[model samples]
Structure formats: structure tokens, C-alpha cells
Target chain A: MGAEREPERGAERVVVGDKRKLRLATASLAGCFGCHMSLLDIDERLFELVERVDFDRSPLTDIKHCGACDIGLIEGGICNAENVHVLREFRSHCKVLIAVGACAVNGGLPAQRNHLDLGQCLQEIYLTAPDIVGGKIPNDPELPLPLDKVHPIHEIVRIDYFIPGCPPSGDAIWKFLTDLLDGRTPRLGHPLLHFD
Target chain B: MTQPSILLDGLPVPFVDGQTIMDAAMAADIFIPHLCHHPEFKPQGSCKLCTVKANGRYVSACTLPARDGMEVENNSPDLNDKRRTLLQMLFVEGNHFCPSCEKSGNCMLQALAYELEMLSPHFDQFYPNRAVDASHPEVLLDFNRCILCELCVRASRDVDRKSVFSLSGRGIDKHLIVNAESGRLADTDFSWADKAAHVCPVGVILKKRSGFAVPIGKRRYDVEPIGMQVERLAARSADEES
Candidate 1:
């Protein structure tokens, strides 16, 4: 918490003594969680990453919401009102927002339903499916209402960076993060930019 | 007479007098990203991914013929940004669920998008509802994935000589239609072994009952990027000709 202050003029001199770790927040909106799993695929490097960055509010720390942070890594598409809210919150709170994986970047598999009528989709899933014993399209006031169509996060918010893949490879993620931390624009080329 | 040469990104590429910029580049083992220009068929500059700047003017490499001293610019940031936008339009225009599609790895459209490093669709999803034609006994025509490159149309007319496929409609409504009164592949003389069936660059024309036989990671573009394959093939052809 002590390290979360906004830098004042000439704060660079004071920061040499403070030694604040950069804060990172992450969230999954409407994806399969494959991207988050791929992040963990960084494996042993997680130890090194933890030393350089702190989890401000993320699934890694099971934090409910984000605080003022240096970076935000968002996975998944915007499928409902709740996603829109969380995305806007991240934009306001974080200085840099990175849309990670195919879903976050291009609506991925979930956007396949974009061609189908939302009402018919809900009816098929919730009421007409063979496995359902007694099901209804749950319209609880607490639940988020579905958007007419799924959308990539960038269509709704300003995303500073994108890592594209069904689940972007661990190496790509590592390179992007380390490059960002080292003050370089991440360029995905050759083997790094795979779609399947 | 000696062959005329064009400068592609400052590299000299020799071309036959009548060859398009794309054909000359391919013969030189250079890759200009494209979807509609298959070697087996006539060039159709439908997919403009192979757009390159020639002497400060942008033109589709697939259709534009090469001329002596022509200076072509490819693989640049400005051109790639435009290519990325074109790829994005294709993505959102159709429901391209790469993770679930049978042609996930082998699809040229997906591979080109990857090569361009198109991070996001960068546009709203159109999600145009399209139908799948599983009526054919040995082939599946999933219209959802068609990029309208006209490869199948050209292959059927020129190679198979069956005239089994044709494009119908205009603009957003344009689609691949079977060449039959009933408008179904089953009603036509189309077969799985036809050149038209094999010429589809995307998942639109998939062989029935042959899904995922090669496994995910070992698929065509998965093993090597599409550009590398084109370059390798070009090199092999050049070697054979010499």
C-alpha cells in the first residue's frame, strides 16, 4: 500500500530510496480460463515474476477488485454488462491494459454465437437441451444480462497491447511482459504469432 | 531475350513478360501474403492481403503484372497495418471459431492473419448467419468459413471442368452456391476427389469423416508457417526448372 502513491515532481530522486514494486492486476471476463492457465505455463519463471511485480487485485491473489495498478492483463471477451463494467474499471484504475489471448482480443470461440440469435441460444441451452431436468433462462436481478453479441475487449475499452492465440504461448507472454517492463514495445513475429 | 526483373523490397526478382507481381515474387521464393491466388488456378484479386506498394502506388500483387524497373514495397509497417485491417474484416464477417474448426491449423486465412500479427479483429463482429451443406456424401461445405476467394470456382471450371461451384449474390450477401437447380451439393456432380473440392483454402470445403486425423500440432501450417511453405515450394520449383 505504501508503494502505491502517484509519483510527484522530482519523485524520481525519492523513488531511488522507496524501491516500489510495479503492481499488476488480471481478470477473466467470458473466456474458458485457458489464457490464465497458459500464464501459469510460464512455470518456474513465476518465482522471478513475483519478485518483480506485485499482485494488486488478481485471480492469482483471489482479490475481488482492482486497485490503482501499473498494468492490467485481461483475458476473455465482453459478453455481458458485467464484463463491460469490469473492463471500464480496469481502464480507469490501470495505466496500461493488455488484452491477452484470442477471446480477449477477437471474441474467439464465444463469438461463434454471434451469428445465432441470443434468445434462441438461451432457449436451447437453458430449456430445450436433453440433459436439463427443470431449467429456465435464469433472470435473477443479481445476474448480469447477456449482451446481444459477444465483443472483444478492445471494442469496448482502449487496450494498449494484445497477445493473440487461442491461448497465447507462455514464451510470448513472458517476452511481452519482460519487454514492457524493460521499456520496449513487444513485437510478435514468426513462431510467436500462431493462431491454432 | 533476357527476362525482365522487378525490384521487390530492393531485391531483384526475374519475371516472365506476362507474369503478375505475385507470380514473379513466388518464382523468386519470395512470399507476398495472399488468399485468393492459388498457383493451380487463375489469379482472383478478391482477398487483398497481398497488396504491395509499387513505385509509391498501392496495388494487389496477385493481379498487377510485373514490369521492368518496378519498385515494390512489401513487409513494411504501413502495408502490414492495412493487411491486418483486411484480415480483421474477414474475421468479423464470418464466424471463424479456429479452436473448434476442423481446419484450425491448415486454414490459410488463419495462417495469414497470424503472419500479419493481427492481434485483434479490431472491428465489430458481423456474425452473418450462414448454412452448412452436409448434403454431399463425401464432403462438407460449411459456408460460415468461406472467404470468397473464388479458388473453388476457378478450379471447378478450369481444372475439374465440372462447373460445380459458383458465387451468388453481391456484397455482404455474396456466397458460394452449388451449380445445381436445387442449390445443394448433393444434387450436383461434385465429388470429394474433384480439384474444386481440394482448392478451398479455408474450412468451407472439408472432406467428410476426415476431421483431425493429423492431430492439432502436426497440421500443415502448425508445423511451418504458411509463408515458409510457399517459399519452400517456390524454391523446389525453381530448382526443378533449372
Candidate 2:
């Protein structure tokens, strides 16, 4: 999809090449792939997205980091130190960064663990799980290091837009995406978001 | 025509079909655990403590609205275990110190915990580092005791339309927030009449100059366990909804 071309209602529209180039990439940080899946849940329209936007650096379309994209859609929370780096890069590289799910936006169910100490949980999970063992504990090297506290993206980096919910309803994501494609900042007009 | 008996823990107890489970328990003298429910004010079943496995599935006793065939087991080993775990989570999330708390002796949460035979929280502490805001001159903030049931926030938002209270953060970091610029509640437009003070189930939010005013022996929650009270209220409410 080109940055300058707009879609023509109901049907997905395509603006060829750099004529309307709207660079886009997606990254999944520290969350279940649920939010990413929701993006595709837009159904056949997502295939239309392929015709319109530059598909880069998404696990769905590409396997690289977004070097410099117009929009970076992030899914997950800023749990530890590595999350800070990812967020910073996205903020600097992408013209817009959207916190994509309950986890990324407000630190959802995983944040429930925030009630307890981090060391306590690591001990319980690694040492106390019936099947887990000292060496058997899986730790991803690429994973952002675990922090004592899990934080929402806004806590670490300024997010241009937030799409909250365990993964906001699919239609809501679509609405936001369309607005961004049309070249205007989209707002989540819900009162709850404004109460704070 | 019936101050009828409903089977509770195998014995026939007085059954008032329209009252809440908590209220029926109170009338029949049985106990059901609960919080965020009050007699003077309306019952807002946000706390989810009064949840019970009635007939097979989990249902909040206060909000479920009882039925005639409802076979309630207030002290069943299985149901009590769930209550224990839920109560433990509430304790860990914010802060609820029984000792040194104004609501300690008469608190609904404390009473339910005692009824469930809880000696102490088996889990680790969640000390969230929240501050106490005693700004209104009438109310106080005890960050440790909030369970985020959202009853107070709801009451303020829906009934009063005050927009003075809200819940910010989410999951475990979720805590009650005051509507102010600095995130300081005392700086807002809340007042004694807001009664946001009375809605808290734990000591997290307390009213100043109102503590212990009812005398130890006269306190309502201290006199009976919450489970029984929920049983009674559930029966009445079910009839209303149906």
C-alpha cells in the first residue's frame, strides 16, 4: 500500500509501489501470540492489506526487525531490560508505535504476577513446579531479561496510540488501522481510556 | 406460606426464596463469605468473594439470585478451598493488614478469611509500595487493603456520576485511583458524602472520624460471618430478577 493513497470503502484498495508507499512492520515482544493472531482475524481483508501496505519484519510476513518503518505494531509488555531496548528502537524507527494488547497497553494477566516478587515467582516456577528442574528451566536468550516488575509500554516509552484489551476486539484494530492508513492519528474514543 | 427449610451442609435451614444467599444464610444462621456488599447501601457484587459452586458451577452468591432447588453447601471442603485461594489472591494484590487496621475486627474480608480457617497467607508478599492518602479530611487511603473489586469505582462512576474514582493500572498492578492531576486522590473533588470511603471491603479506604463509631459489639460484620449473610440476600434478589 502506498502512503499517499486511500482505500475506497468496503473493498480493499491498492496504491502501487512507492507512489503511495506506507511502510509497516509488526513485532511481538513478551506476550502470547494472541494479539498478532487478532490482526489476521480481520479475515480476508488482511489479504487485502498485503496488496496495500509494505509488509516488512513481521513474523507473519518477514523475519527481520523493522529497520525503518512508517508504523510499528507491537504486541506484549515491557517486562524487563530487553523490552526497553525494543521499545526505544520502535519509537525511534517507526513514525508511530501502537501498544497492541492488554499486556502491551496495561500489562494484563501477566501483570497479575506483579502482585508478588519476581524472585519469588522465578523460584516457585523453576524450583517448585512438579516437572521442572534446575537445568530444565527454559530461558530464551532473545527474550527480554525478566524484570522485578512488568511494566506497560507507556511506563518505559511514549506510545503514540494504545489499543487496550486482552487484545482489543478485531473490529477496533481494523478501525484504527484504516484511520492510520488515511494519514490521521487515530484515537480510542472510549471514555474509560479518557478517565485516567 | 414458608419459613421453609433448604438443605445446607445436609441439614434443613430456613429458606427464603427471594433473599440473597448471604441474607438467607444470615436468617437461617449459616455463613457465606463476601465483601463489597452492604445493607445501608446497595449490594454491588464486584468483589467476587461470595462465589460458590452451587449445584455444580461457580456462581457469585450475592449476584446469582437464589432459586428454590438451590442446594447450597456453605462449608463443603471443595468450595471452601476455592474461597481460600481467591481470598489469598485478594490479600496478595494490594494490602490488607488485619492488625493495626481500623476495620480489622469488623471487616467483611477479615471475617470471611476467619470463617474459611485461614491462619495466614501461604504466598509471598506483594508490597506494592503504594501511599496512603488521607487528603479529604474525611477519608483515608490504605493502599495495602484494596482488592480492586471496582465496587467503589463503579458506584462513583455509575450511581454518583462523580467520576471522582477509577481503577488504573491492570492485572496485579491494578489499584483504585483518584481523579486528580498528580495521581494524588486527596487533591480531587471527593467529599465525605462521596461515600467512596464506605465502599471498600478492606482497610485500603477508610473514613476518618467514622472508625469504631458503632462500638465493637455493635459492628454488623463482626457479629456474623459473611457467607451466611450472602445466603440470605441471594434468595431475595433472585426473586426480584425473575
Candidate 3:
């Protein structure tokens, strides 16, 4: 509402003035870096995103562990305390919270480890996989956090949108951003978003 | 697609809604060359070979939504040139060793390439160093022959919701990555019963032991092509579901 006007042609986009530039932020928890990398998939179009929205605390651009903003894009699953705190803060601050990849949307890849007991998976990956880190973190704790089960972002807070994909394709990301910034509801595009 | 549509080289053709101009032309006995757009999978416009002139713009008939008064040209001289170039793009991009391929007799890509009379790939080979992960207890992978139409990715991710497969890398470096870590599908939770091994449009992904079970020159699809395979598969799917 900050002096943003109707788009010159479409119902959205400001024709003039400060353009009510939406304050935005993004973060990740415990999934593959693939989701964040998908943002880079935009190649050159990412410049348009920088111009349209203000990224206040993205892991890529910002140093602050957390911040208040309008749009919070959380990529990765919740398997630790840091994930919980960051997710809650984003939920409280952002006007719209988007679970921005498959892991965030429906407990993607990391959750694949759910098939076995947490202890067993830890022992298998560390003690069993070809190369063992062997208490690599030393005093540091392992994932699965013992007694608690891994959960998706929606389980912890209300999510306004879900952009699914192992990592969603760049075109899907572009469409969603265009739709949201333009105040139009977005439909999930490309069957990949629905894919694992 | 409501009326008997426009010319296919001056021949009158019929069309129906919820179908493409290619379908309409095919119904009127006109032939068009396309590699990736089997009537089975969702209309992937990746190949752009099935592209036809609709109201003077080059649009892929397989994926375009038809409208009234749309003038479609299926076999104009310019369109044939466009299609031949697109087919050549596919032909040169991958290792389509037709002499050694199993689906040679029934493959849509090979059949279309032959129909276009393409004798040699016009460009340099990509020669991607992809390892064949025949790791699935039931399925096989020959990464050399993959065209990345994403049919297997869709069938697994969308239909089965298994997400057992994915595409890694991008552009020229892009290739299929299955399961998770080992890149071995059997290491993940894929089962023999999953239909992903059945619907792959190319010979890249195959049903391992099931290969040649139907025998050469006698496979059910040898004479019928994919349109009928889809119809029969749909019926089989419904029967299995019930």
C-alpha cells in the first residue's frame, strides 16, 4: 500500500512512484541446497526479482540469522531446533509464507530417511556409508534429533503457498513470483513441482 | 477443433475439441513427423517437431489449445523444413544407435526419423559420459539414449507420487538422476510393480528382465504405435485399479 499503483497494463505493477516495494526474506533449515540453487536457475531474470522485491534476510545475501519481512521463503525440512525457531519467526513476520521447495512443502529428500529408525540411519550414514565422518562434529549432535520425528513446514506453521519440486524449475518460480507480486493467485505449473 | 478444419496440403480434414490439429490431420490420413509427443504422455513441447502452422504462427499441435477459425497448415513447405530441422536436432543430440536398439521396429523416434528420410545426423555428437544405471531390480537405464522428455520423471513424481526419479544438471549437462544417493534406483524404495518401467517413451529406460519377453517383430506395439498403446494401457490401468 506504500504508494504502489495499478500496473500500467495488468491489474498489478505500479505505473509510477515508490511502488510499495514488498519487503522479502528467505532461509533454509535441513535439506539439500538444491532448493536455493533453483533460484539461480532463473539465470538472468533474477535481476528482475531484485528490482521488484527487497530481500531483507536471505541466506544468499544477508548475514542476519533472522529478520522481519513481508515474504518468507523457507527451503528445506525441519529436523532441528534452529529450523523451528527460524520457521516460527518467518511465520510471525511475513505477510505470506511460501514453503519454497519440495522439502519445505511435503518433507522432501531428507524425509526419505524416515523409512528407518533415526539411530539406525545415523549409524548407517556415519558408521556405515563408504566414508565415515566418525563423530565429525565431535560434541555436536546428529540429525533426526532422537525422540522427535522430522516434519514439514506446514506442520509447524500455517503456509500460504507451496512451491513443490525436488527443486522447483525456474519457470515455475518466475510464474509464482509474478502472480504474487501482481496480486494474482498462482497455480502450480509444470508437473515437476508435484514430483518428488 | 469443432469443424472439419483447414488444409493439409489442400486436403480437407476433420477435428474435434479436446484434441490437437495433428490428431485431426491424422484422422484425415495425413502424416506429420514428431519424436517426443507420443499420444500417451502429456504433450511435452520439448521436441517442437510436431509444430504446425496455426493461423501463420509456428505452434506445436501436440500441446496447443485449439480455437475456432484457426487456420492450420500441417504439411506446407516451410513447416516441413521446420520439422526436418527439429528432427535433425534430436538425431544429432543423442546416441541413437538404431542398428543396436531394441525398440528399432516400434520406436516412435526412429520411425519418425525414418519417415523424414534422415540418413545421417547433421551435427557433432554430444557424447555425454553418462553411466547406465541398470540398478533397478526391474528397470534398466541406458543414459546414452535418453532425450529428457521427462515422461518417467512425470509418471513417477506426479502419478505415483513416489518422486523416485529426478533430472539433475541443466542444458547440455542435463541427465536423469534416479533414487537419491547411489544413483541406483533399487537402493531407493522403487518396486517392480511401479508402472514407470512400462511407460518410458524411449529405450533408455527399460524393464530389465522384461526386455524381449514380447520378442522382436512380434511385440504388440510393432504394428500399432503409441496411440493404441495409450488406449489399451488406460483400460488396463482401470482394470488394475478396480
Candidate 4:
């Protein structure tokens, strides 16, 4: 099937056969690297992917700050002040932002702590545990202060699309990216759309 | 005279005197999505997933009786979007970790979410601090996954005559509880074979030692979506009656 064009979202659509490739960036915060690992599982297709898009800021490039990009893929939820800052910065730099995974979409497993009092949780782990000798809660100014509850990325910034899975499969990621590259609104069918 | 019928999204559905809109639609092989509804149990209109416009008024199909010549809107885009919102509400209300959940594929909540195309929870996560009750040797109760459907409560009380479960608390504090002073399943006379044991639509009630027995790809909703499964079941039942 021919790829369908999507409505523009603050960025120019990538034209196929154009020498200039689309700029793509990715970020992970308060999430396990499972989503990134799945992205790598795109394996051989990564060669084809690089041909269509130039990596701007990602672990693959080790570029800490995101530059102006066409697409930004965010993984994980907002659990700390730093995560909020990073997410906002990414939103400002990228034209289209996609929340990629259960964590970024709905605050995955780490959000299990949302009901517990953050102070009590820290105390229970650091001071009252069985193995404790002279334990105390760490008081470092450099530490990113934890938010009271975990929040999905959309709660912090506008999201153009959402890819919902624990860590969406390698094939799912490939399909989504290729759809964007081809100017189609990414639509994940039964096999691709999964939470687990 | 003639069989009583209702117009379901412009399609006619025949029904008997006492059948609800849900029953009529099911018998006609038209799927009206629902949760907290079982053919064997008394209809509880708590979930609101089966809401439909009955003659221009919204009502829960499971509880609203079908009337002859009544027009009902079942599969409209507006209704489906509302259902998606309800599903999203349920998702964020509980701490649902689908990746690690034992009931992932076979779970009705997950299956219905997929059926309705719910991409994200759409709301802030509550992440309630509920405990798991593993006291029963043959069963497990993960309070984090309960949608407060009360299916187990009805199954235990009406089918098994055991009254082994009940819901306690009000509003947001509402939750399922075992029928024992100790608040443990092992302290009660509950059995794995009880009807309530297997009635849970979510991961709240899980059978011990049987998790992952069926691989991920082989589970109930893996090959077919829940809508098709419901329709297929309806067709089979209609065939049996004929």
C-alpha cells in the first residue's frame, strides 16, 4: 500500500529521494533501557533507517543535548525535576514528539510507588531496613529531587503520537519510523499494537 | 404475535419479553462491548462500558431492557470514544503492569482495551498501594488489578452459595475483600473449583502454579480480537439453540 501523508506538525515533511535526511533524536528518563534495546533489535534495518534519518541526539550518538530535529522519541515517565526539564527541552527542539513505551505513555512499572509517601518510602529503604547499620537518607544538592508521583510524558509536554507497549517490539518501532519517514500517520494494527 | 425487536445501530434485533438490550444484541451476533457482565450472573450496570443511546437517551445495555421498535445506537464513534475514555479511567485507577502480569493476554480488561484501540491511559496513574493475598494455596489475589467488577462476588454468592467475597469501603476507597475475619483466603473455606475462582476478568484472581502455562502467542485474545471472539461465541450459542 502506498504511504498516506500526515498533517504537518511544526516541521516540513521529508520528501523521499531528497539528499537531506530528516533529523531524529531520542531520550530516556526514569525508564529501563528495554525500549532502547528494542530499538536496537531493529538490527539490520538500522542501516536502512540511518540512510533516511540523521541521528541528532541519542545514546547511539552520545550527544547529550538535542539539537533542532524533525522527530523526537521519548521513553520513560517524569519521576524527577530533571526529567521534566529534559522533556521540556526535547519538546522545544523537536517538531514532532512521540511517547514510546508503557513508561512514557502511562508511567509503567516504576509508577507502582505512586501510592506510597515518597518520604516514608525513602525512610523505609534507607533507615528502617533489616541490614541497616548507621543508614541515613542521602542529602545531596546534585541529586534530582524526586517528584511525589510518576507522570506520563504527555502530562509534562505535548505529544504528537504514542507507541504503547512495555517496550514496543523491534518490528513495531521499525513500522512506526518507516511510516513517519514515508509521510504516513503511523497506524499499528493488531500485531503491532500491544501493551505487553 | 411477532417476536419483539429493537433497532441496534439501524439493524433489527429480536428478543424475548424479559431480555435486556445486551441479551438481544448478543443473540443477534451484534457485539455491544461490556465488562462486569456475565450471562450467568445478575446484570450489574457498574462498568458503563456497554452504554448505548436508547431512543436518544444513554443507558447501560446490560441493565436496560430492550423494547420493541426502540432505536438504539451501539457502535457509533461518539459512544466508542466514550468507552475508550472509561477504559482509560480503569487503567489509571489501578496499578496495571501488563508486561509482568500473569493475566496479560487472557485478561478481559487488556483485551477490551485492545478492542477499543486505547493507545494510552490518557489520565494520571493512581498507583494505589494494594497488597497481594497469596495465603490461599491454590489461588492468588492481586488487589492492584481489580476493576471492582464484583463478578467474583456475585459468582461466589449466587453460584457457589459460598459468599466468600464481598466489596468493602466507599467511592475511591472501595475494594474486594475475602469473607473472613482474618482477611486471608486460606482462613476461609474457599476452593479453587468454586465458580468465583475463575470468574475474574482481570488479573485480580489468578490460579496458582498455572500462570504462563499457555505461552503468550497462544492465549485467548492473541489470534482474534475480543469483538470477534464475542461474536463467534454468540453464533455458536445461536446454532446450539436452533
Q: Name the candidate, 2 or 4, with the larger TM-score value.
A: 4
> Candidate 3: misplaced stretches above 4 Å?
A1-196, B1-18, B23-31, B212-242
TM values, all candidates? 0.90, 0.46, 0.47, 0.88
Q: lDDT tens string, model 3, B152-201? A: 77778777778887788988778788867777877877765765655555
> What are the per-residue Cα lDDT tens digits for candidate 1 across A51-83?
779998888899988999999999999999999
- Model 2: how far is B11 from its true place, Å? 4.7
| Model 4: docking quality category | medium
Candidate 1, overall lDDT?
A: 0.85
Question: Which of candidates 2 and 4 is the stronger one according to lDDT?
Answer: 4
**Could you say which candidate leads in DockQ?**
1
The digit string of per-residue lDDT tens for model 4 on A71-187 reads: 999999999999999899899999999999999999887776787899999999999999998999997999999999988998888899999998899998999999988889888
Q: Per-residue alpha-carbon lDDT of model 4 for B215-239, expressed as tens digits?
A: 7677777777788776543221111
Q: What shift in Å separates residue B239 of candidate 2 from its native position after superposition?
A: 33
Ranking by TM-score: 1, 4, 3, 2
Please estimate how well model 4 matches the true structure, expressed as its whole-model Cα lDDT: 0.87
* Poorest 10 consecutive residues by lDDT, candidate 4 chain A: A1-10
Best-to-worst lDDT order: 4, 1, 2, 3
| lDDT score of residue A153 within candidate 3 | 78
| Chain A only, candidate 2, TM-score | 0.79
CAPRI class assigned to model 1:
medium
CA error at residue A87 for candidate 4, angstroms: 0.9
